[model samples]
Target: MNTFLNPFHLMKRIMLIVTLLLIVSCDGYQSICGLVIDSETKTPIEKAIIKTINPKFKAYSDKNGYFEFHNVTGFIFSDNDLTVVISKVNYINDTLNIKNGDSKLVKLIKTE
Candidate 1:
């Protein structure tokens, strides 16, 4: 009989299949974690609104100007373009490219 069809080969195939299944069953999600800061003063900007489209997701900066959003599907199965909009009261809206699974530094300019 061919060694390829032996029980060892069969067991190996089953293990391979199980491994693939486990990988596919994992959560297909991305995340964006960062801090929002002032363009000039370089200080943290609290209460900033962060929004991303194409499987839309939103988050707000905390008192330390830190923001994070998980389970992001930023243009995953679509176009390569991903946009992130950061805005706050009396501040110039800052538009940035989405960087999945990375920490970013978002700067906003104050409008007067």
Candidate 2:
């Protein structure tokens, strides 16, 4: 039987291609989450701005110092490094190199 003429075989091939595409595309997006805290005081730093430099995604730390960015783009399986900047008033800015789907604890020092 010619494979092209077989409806079931064609369907299977199409599904396989679609499945591969989905798997490959899944690696391109990821979520980032972290907590911001005062380095000296060990206290949560609220209202801190957290952002990714390359993709320009931003989120603010809540009262609990938790921030998250969902479905951020440009992160693939091979190159998943992201640069994050965290800043708040009176606090020295912090820069971090983190991977996609990472939850990190960040500490910021207060400027004298």
Candidate 3:
């Protein structure tokens, strides 16, 4: 049987195209990393919460104000934008939008 004229071959080709299309259509996840700091003092804020919504998750900033949500759970599927909220005691919460392997420096203001 001519491969191109075979029914099974046609079905396989169609299936391959459909699979590739689905994969291309999806907005995939990525690794997110950043730092949280005090707006006034320009110092790192330890133990600050970094997170997202819907498929919610929370990560804490280390003593150096560094935080990371690696590709595994930190996966965000949007228009290449991931919004994360950062909060800690005595500090006003802040939000950050990280994109495509981009890291950020988030500064939170202190409460009076």
Which number leads on TM-score? Answer: 3
Off by over 4 Å in 1: 1-27, 74-81
For candidate 2, write residues 1-112 as lDDT tens digits. 8979799999999999999898787746777899999999899999999989988998999999999998888736656678999999999999998887789999999999
Inter-residue clash pairs, candidate 2:
none
- Local lDDT at 106 for model 3: 92
Per-residue lDDT tens digits for candidate 1, residues 1-112, read 8988999999999999999888766655677788999999999998899998666788899999999888775333433445789999999998887656778898888898
Question: What TM-score goes with each of the models?
Answer: 0.67, 0.74, 0.75
Cα lDDT tens digits, model 3, 1-112, are 8999899999999999999888767655677788888999999999999887534778999999999876534323444567788999999888777775778999899999
Error of 3 at 17 (Å): 4.8
lDDT for position 91 in model 2: 91
